[model samples]
Target: MPIAPKHLKFDDGSVTIIGVDCATQSSKVGLALGSMSKGLLTIDKAMKVGKSGSIANVVSSWIRENSTTKTLIAMDSPLGWPIKLGEELIGHTAGSSLSTEAHQMFRRRTDFFIKEQANKQSLDVGADRIARTAHAALRLIDEIKEQVGMSIPLAWNSELRHPISVIEVYPAVTLKSCRLLSATSYKKESNGAREQIVDGLSEFMTLPEADKQSIIDDDDILDAVACVLAGSHFINNESVGPATTEDSALAEKEGWIWARMPR
Candidate 1:
């Protein structure tokens, strides 16, 4: 993959941090705008996003309905998807990886880049890509403004006056955080793990008042979204996990193995 331009502007509008999780039937969103005084992230708005991804109207309707503009969007989709879109929005070829194939290409190039960078500077090649992306875009942003409609950031966060961040979270994080150890364990017991779907829905509805009994079964999409959210949170500074370090090496006579590379 080609490297980004050295002197490119990434920020153009008031940025906002938006966290998205395509929950159950709805896309649950959590947005944090940089405080005017602090310029740090904070939860200022939220919503349950839904979309009909037809064509050019894939993401704009939701943005229009929500009146979300002048804010950079941060999604949890693999960087390749939105990277291409971001480039296209500005009418250019994205320098980042292009597709799943590009990700595989990254695998081939990782060693080269790692050796080159490590030889030059003794820095860890496995440093957080998302955070680095966020920071670098903020520092060197220079893109001609073109109308874009997608759930990804066209402009970097730093350029915005009141920047907002959008992160895609995952539900498994929520379930795990809720202490749902094993799905089977929860199902056979009397606790509340079985209620995860409802619990998540309740949250989606702001724990709606005068609740009528409704049925909920699985949480596939919800869990996926929650995972996105969790992954996003971990990417952002909001989640600083001091989780214990444990080494579990099924280290076979293999080429390589990286168990839980630090976030």
Candidate 2:
């Protein structure tokens, strides 16, 4: 028998969505503003955060500007490290043998789950350059919380009505789920792949012609828009979450990547 669909009960009329394609350097970080109202999603703006030296300032300014609307910040970066890596490193010496295997220590449960469901594996935060991006993401969250004067928690439920909430998103998995271009393909020199991706995305959200061209010109901008679509899947209760209690427990510490199931 087929399984029944599960959905989060979100009843709000409208909400602002910000998709952040985070990077270690502020110049490479991309930000996109979007909105969902009465079941329609629209992309309002997209741009690089610029060489402002601080991504928090740009994001905080946007938040302050849209203070009246509930906002969801979907970031394209890991928010936490592997739970096993943290647990196994406690009180360890330089030459001590680790209890957990290297693969398990480097990957979180959510990483494995995404691979199993979407066939798209996220980078290992414990042993990759992406670790720096992950650190930046966490620090950015803390800085934003301090600047905004609000508790910006990692949202687990779609119906979370907090004034400001954040969630980790993987644009690659989202693109795969939507049958668009692969993440690496669109970042190449040619803009053909990106144009195709924008065309595919237009079926779901309203994208201005100028913004669509901007997204095609920059991979970071495209990923930021994809992040918004992933967040939309979460809000519409189409994205997968932790299925087991142990998965949930690990996700609480290691963070979860919000994306739709494989097509």
Candidate 3:
């Protein structure tokens, strides 16, 4: 609930975008790196985190290798624990007396805002709904910190405006915003749902017809691609959601989710 920051611009041809969807199952974690050149996005690297060894090591290495080049990472995980949840998890004195209503009201401002904009509900990071993902994400953050020496969890993407930046992204909202698929329908493995989602994303992103099959088969990959697309907008200064003042305390403590951009 803070005033948004000024748009941060990047040199069009120099930015490399990374997208990641973190999951408890290493195999389900998606990773992709790409760049826009001449109006076309070329996915230069794509893989499942499990296959690449430590997700932290792999991603941090890639980021460091590209540190000299403008880069923006769009991650599909809660980068920071919600303010209320953090207290609850650690048994802070302030949250000891919080009631259910108080807990509900204390959800991250960005989470509610993004849900409203995307017309879909996101699991509250403070609740059990996303405990596993949050845990995994926190581990990944730790790994990045140890390996890349970056404080991704607490870094301010807007103010940094550095060669390497990070933002949280939600794939379902991204897909829905692109009008490619309903967020719920395509994520499952049943009834060719996965294939449908893949095909739709391939078509929508204008990926090469011959190359579509390879990247589209995995839901993780699709989400990663969507994350990269979101990062693309981010570098272009077209992203949504950033709290600078209104709930400054909570905003800084619970990093915001930067969702879909206008077409």
Candidate 4:
């Protein structure tokens, strides 16, 4: 894998990355915090948000606690909808005929790009239950921004000097990039499958026994950890980005999913 050109350089050790497996309900969301130093990734904390907790509150608290470290938040949810869908819906009537293709209207350019690059398809944010999750994720980001008093923009590269930054990630695609996908379903109640995944992940980062056990016990926690891995790839410039000028324009509106490409 080639390292993409960096727009700005900074110490990897100074940055703190958080992976959030976002969901509509706080109880289903997973959060993890880690940092990379000397090419080794260390996970300091990982947990579910619990029924009474709030994602924004937890994240803002972390920002306040770690005031000096740059924070990169990688969330597992679509941050934007298709550009065509929004354009076509402006004057769309109940009985009007739509000109755009269904897939183009529902899916963003980044969605198709992920399918081609990672051989995985993300759910259509314009036409799926995932849309609700996306809405919740964006709302949570806004709340965090309000609380932290910073413009937490979606980062395009690793130059994160801001107090906070965000990126979209897909854990399934991250798993595929790492060749960790197995015939056995890890998302099910099978600890054996989850254990296999944690074992495979050891090749990329060192996981404490407790963190490994927590990840194996819950698929959400595993995904949150995977999101952290994706964040690592992004911060290191190992993840793929916009391929063309047009694609870059579309990504600003439709949002991009930063994941490590399969080797």
Best by TM-score: 4
Whole-model lDDT for model 1 versus the true structure?
Answer: 0.30
lDDT of model 3 at position 147: 74
Which residue pairs come into collision in candidate 4? none
TM-score of each: 0.33, 0.92, 0.77, 0.92
Model 2, residue 261: what's the lDDT? 84
lDDT for 16 (candidate 4): 77
Per-residue error for 26 in candidate 2, Å, reads: 0.6
lDDT against the true structure, per candidate, is 0.30, 0.85, 0.67, 0.87
Residues 80-152, model 4: lDDT tens digits: 9999998999989999999999999999999999999888889999986899999999999999888877778
Q: How accurate is candidate 3 locally (lDDT)?
A: 0.67
TM-score of 1: 0.33
Off by over 4 Å in 2: 1-11, 182-184
Q: Write the per-residue lDDT of candidate 1 for residues 75-172, one digit (tens) a residue.
A: 43222222222333455366743444433223222222223322211112123344343233222221111123222333212333332233322233
* Best model per lDDT: 4
Provide the lowest-lDDT 10-residue window in model 3: 1-10
- What tens-digit string does per-residue lDDT give for candidate 3 at 1-263? 11112333445456677788888877788888777655566666767856546887777777666654556777888866666665555655653665446545446778777766666677777667476887897787677767765455343543445545677888877776667665356666653665666666655445544545546667787788888877765555555756457755666777777766434
Error of 4 at 60 (Å): 1.5
Please provide, for model 2 over 1-263, each residue's C-alpha lDDT reduced to its tens digit, 9 standing for 90 to 100. Answer: 11111322343687788999989898899888888888899988888867866778777877776665678999999898897898899878999898999879999888999889887778999997899999888898899888877778889988765778999999988988888965557888898889889989999899977777789899999999999998899989998999999989988999999889877
Better of 1 and 2 by TM-score: 2
